[model samples]
Target: MAVVTRTEPPPRPPRRRRLLYRLRVLRHDPTAALGLILVVLLAYLVVAPLFAVLSDAFRLQYGDEVHAGQQPGEWTGYYLWRVFRSQISRLLFWEPLVNTLVVAVGTTLFALALGGGMAWLVTRTNVPGRRWLAGALVVPYMLPSWTFSLAWLTLFKNERAAGQAGFLQAQGIRTPDWLAYGPLPIVITLGLHYYPFVLLLVGNALRRIDVQLEDSARILGAPRRTVVRRIVIPLMLPALSSAVLLVVGRVLGTFGTPYVLGLPADYRVLSTGLFQSIRDRSTGVASVLATVIVIIGIVIVFTDMRLMREQRRFVTVGGKGAMDRVSDLRRWRWPACALGMAVFAVSVLVPVLTLLLSTVTRIPLNLSTFTLDFWIAEELPGAVGFPHGVLRGPELWEAAWNSLRIVGLASLICAVAGLLVGYVVVRGTAPRIAAFLRQVSFLPYLIPGIAFAAASLSLFAVARGPVPALYGTTFLLILVMAVTHLPYSSRSGIAAMMQLGREPEEAAQIAGASWWQRMRRIIFPIQKGALVTGIVLPFISGLKELSIVVMLTTTGTQLLTTLSIGLVDYGYTQLANGVVLMIALLSFTMTYLTQRLTRSSLASGLGG
Candidate 1:
């Protein structure tokens, strides 16, 4: 017995035992297993495409053998030189880069001022119609950002681009090219479109700032300006910085507004420049541009994170709830209300009304020329190839159906996947796997939509291993939309789950409920509101998405966005406006219905 005991294996070391215990737990725990699977899937879907794009930038692309004097797939830095150092680099990359930086910085500043001012008015002041202004101001975000560009064109188009003269030009007021098409209009339109990002973020931050802090500063005999400068702004630095980063990141990637407003003036940003390269089949250059955009986006994201960490010292919120004190602007209340209404006029009412007017009349804002021809006429005059009104055309109806079907299915997939991801992130036993899944799911948001679409094309255009090529299929469109929009649903899911306790699942487990049963009966039912918000948010976003769709859609897989852009390319302004209105209507209807059903809103969902 002594000899047998002596020969027995020694007890495992403490660290090794802990590792073995973790392995056993992961093997047995269903949540841990699901987390592991999600990690692998997200890595493939999110990280692999990025790697593909980076590799393509450094490799000799097809037909570029002549240009690079190297074989395809071979490593070369020719694209780097062509985009950054070559003779044509000024036109191809440097100018676009400069223009992009200018527009992005300008848009960020403009959005900050407008949105921050509005947020302060509504959140911290006795501004008349605060509730109405709060909701109305967020409506612009629901419509496509390019909607503002279309409206801008309707009001200001000059003789630069060959088509219909804009309202101003038609009225014998010669709209300057600077006002009609270039950085000015681009910044104005984009800032208007994205200001809500700042509003929501800064509004939340303002609401959280303990009024006592500001009141204390005032009690200490600080002047109003000093109080704001010393207390309010420092407390607001995190939100301000976050909003700046968010707007800048969006401006960097937004393709439609720049394309519509900048193209006529040849004011190319990186996004439009990349689009041009892709259209030219300059794959290497496109890859390099896409890579650069992603790198810039990554830098922004990291900077945001770092600033957030550094600004933690400014936190003044405490365990006790603080009252929100409203500043009195007794005589200025009406003026503040008027200001809010003016913003609504510019950001929402004008754009919607302008697009509507453009669709119904050949000459926008000219009531005498009103007709239903663009919407319902059996045949459209002077519209060859697309001979029917948008309502009467097979193309419009088909594209609408495709958009609803593909985005619907994709949103459903996103909702379910997001819920599962949340479940794993919150309940899984494997911490490392959960964190990896969390991070990888968010990576898509960092990459510009066009770059992500390009990466997706590079990765899935051809088959690899057991996966078949998905180049021209509707499945690819659905897949890309799902991945690109996953962050919204995933964020909503995580936020919802954070408030959920584990008692229900634990009780169900004690009652002999299977993992699926617990999830289906316990988790799903409780998260219904979050699930709906997740689904509808992505549906709204993907329905109007153009940059991603433009890169992936072929003739067979055309979405409403691409359909509208194609009509624009064909110079069918009224019909394009009609399609755009249809998109806005659908998006608004979906968001309205979701909010009504779930008692949740775009602002709250996006904040999460």
Candidate 2:
């Protein structure tokens, strides 16, 4: 009887007891606790601001009180009406909407054609320079997208802009309006910058294709075109769509390129228009436009996700017999090599050389006018407040330091949080929680940078509960940078962690090592390369980030990207180009060093 009484399993432990048990277990288990905390934080940081943007779109804002005839903070459709139906709606919304679509479509097509071709050449064909060309083609992306715009302007700027004539125009070759500014240049520059994205995605997809499929078709007397059409094109469609969506999404949020190129022609896209609204203190208008961008971006992201799901259907599973066969180019080998090198020249060498040439000389490609003044002189003619050269002055150094410190800190945070998130995702017992954490962490990637920045500005511009108002502070920049760039590190972390077995961690745990001890001694030591890559990739991205931080940065908190933009605003072309060169060089050097250290390129982490 006593055994029967005790053997009832203590009345099956009350629900409260079971709940408390879980809580206690979670408290002891760092992964569960960390997962919970990250889910909450990422939801707040990544998802909350999107609601803030939508909220601001309908709710009356401070300056809109006069226009809406409603008190601030009150609900109204006036802002929506103004953006969609009012007199200036076309100018403020419709035209920019059209321009954004046009540019996005144009850029996507151009990027796909160029990137798809290059990917084929490098991965499938017997291209001579494939070894170096593969790495070199990714360089344009490391530099800022606007670097192309700067070069384009340096070479093609017309009298449409008030100040100095471009080199072509300076030599009495007046470039056409379309060549100098507006959608065409925006498309080309963005295409050049983003084609690497396509190359990475499609190229990886191409590499993964099983050559035996094609060989089998060929051995069966199928034509090469038939093999490509049936075997290759069908499999590549998903990657092609993904590349297109990525390019289009980037075009939607990109500010610097469109702003620099579009302004001269009075051409405006949604990003530049949103920026204008923010600058003009048209909060409601900005919120509306930002909401639209976010909506489009979310749609694109969902479509991409769907395509990715469908992509699994096409996965080429292979055994040890699988081999990637490179097609012999025969007499076309030299031509293919020449084409690859030519692309490298146009995309990497040309931009770098163009910026370098512009920095030292007022006139492009002119040796006589070359001077060290832009780099080291204490004073220069017509350069108003920025009297000293970029190299000689405290401004450039301070900005560089801030870029390193703020971006470095942000990236470090990203790396650590990403690693923790990966652990929680890969090793956690609670599937739902882990899945939620993964999705929430990645939500920021789908939100356009400009829209996210606007959302952040709207939500955190004022005090919200425990978090203080962070509008113009350096902390705000760090927070946004970390949150926006979290996807890269998180993906890298998850990929790295999936490959790491639990034996070491389990052994450490069995030896009575605490969770932190296990992570520090076991997990981190094994994932050092991934950790470094996580830090460096985000660092490079945030360093070159313009659209996101541009909205967040105030006069006191200028990053190199913003500082270069500021110089551009002041018409200090040489100094601005000098700063641009610095950014490109720094970005390239960091990427190169990270590749050397990790034995991996930026493309590895970016494959996600």
Candidate 3:
């Protein structure tokens, strides 16, 4: 070798120094700085409470002496053991665990059956009202999950559950115990509510499928059933899993349905049990249940996601433009229309009609009775024995106030934070770290409401080194709402950022402008509409969120969603209905506002 050993080139200063310089520039970059600030703020709001909850579970409280003097702050498996191994274990854990599984499985099956069938019928066969039914089916999904629960109670509640009759009772039918409560009702309600998820997901899948494949099989003498079984189902696996997972995640943390149906039968699911544990001031048991719920959610979600990714292979196979739809059956059109209408009636009209009926009734169960007392009664000091009526009450106002403020604040937090996070993720130079943060933040999405709540509970229980306890504070509510709503926010944020290209910012930088100069002058203005929509969405979702925050706090600190549950629990049906009405109105109004504010921008951003 030639003695001319070239000295190795000195390594450039570590990226850390470069990173600091970049960060300094970012501080000046309004867009970049905005994103970074949001991440920290969100971390504080969302992550801090989680740590507080975790610490609370592990640390000792007033009743530490009850467990034979097991000191507080001492590590013990007592809570876990009690939940899993104690004498009342079945009531606390086993029984509800089964109920959870049954409800989850039932929800998944119903969603698939109803959704998949409709998807197939409309997309492949001569199904009547395919176009109309396709859109109508999505309406229930558009409404919050509890919307159905309220509607279910409004219609099916009998003397056993509500102490008042339902719409059925008014029509001279004693709704059977089976129809009135427990697993069947829970499953039916959740399924009906979520089936639209399946319809949309599977319908999209069906719309992409090639008709030629089916025709080819038929031309080869393959039977209709054979082609469907061999080709359609397999092709549907990905979309099917997506729908299943969505429904499963939804049903897992579902507090409203079980609360409406199961509580009367004394049927317990994890969500209800978690609520009970919290009410009794049993933080440890509640957190543990929350964790298990999260675990179940994770497993289902993991499977669902894997299948979703696997779906990428089923791209539009043919070069032809649009996929063909199943033509309407001319002769059987009436029958097909009837079937579709029946489902639509049950899922949409019936539940809402039931709510309308209940609002005007004095008693929920008995027939041959009617009154508008709940809505317009001015002087029934003892009506429903509540503190107020539907139109007026300190409590009602307080709840409405709480829901609006919290949901509004939380939504704003999520939207702004999500936009920043998304921007950072899409635009950051440190690609790996950005991706890591994005995914980690989204880990909560894979988490079920109960589980994510448990994580927050477990994460925040202790005061830790710097973060303080937040167990019973309003801050905890804000934290959980923000975290639970992160997935939605981030999705919108990332999409919006992607749409707002780098060229404008680059032009600013190229003109000797600092990063902040460009962001203030260029980036934010262009993306403001999209960002606002992101913020607004989380608010909408948070306003109606029930399961995740359900066990996290108690009365006075409760959100409207939780308050509704409490009212129902205390036999305050009218008050609960009032709470629901308030939520629906707020949600609808906000959605309408969002539409008006971003009609043009959103349509462009969404490529509609």
Error of 1 at 208 (Å): 2.3
Clashes (N, CA, C under 3 Å) per candidate: 0, 0, 31
TM-score of 2: 0.92
Candidate 2 clash pair list: none
Candidate 1, residues 219-238: lDDT per residue as tens digits?
98999899889888888899
Poorest stretch of ten by lDDT in candidate 1: 599-608
lDDT for residue 260 in candidate 2, whole number 0-100 = 89
Backbone clashes in model 1, listed as residue pairs = none
* C-alpha TM-scores of all predictions: 0.92, 0.92, 0.87
Q: What is the lDDT of candidate 1?
A: 0.87
User: 11 in model 1: Cα distance from truth in Å?
Assistant: 17
Q: In candidate 1, how many clashes are counted?
A: 0
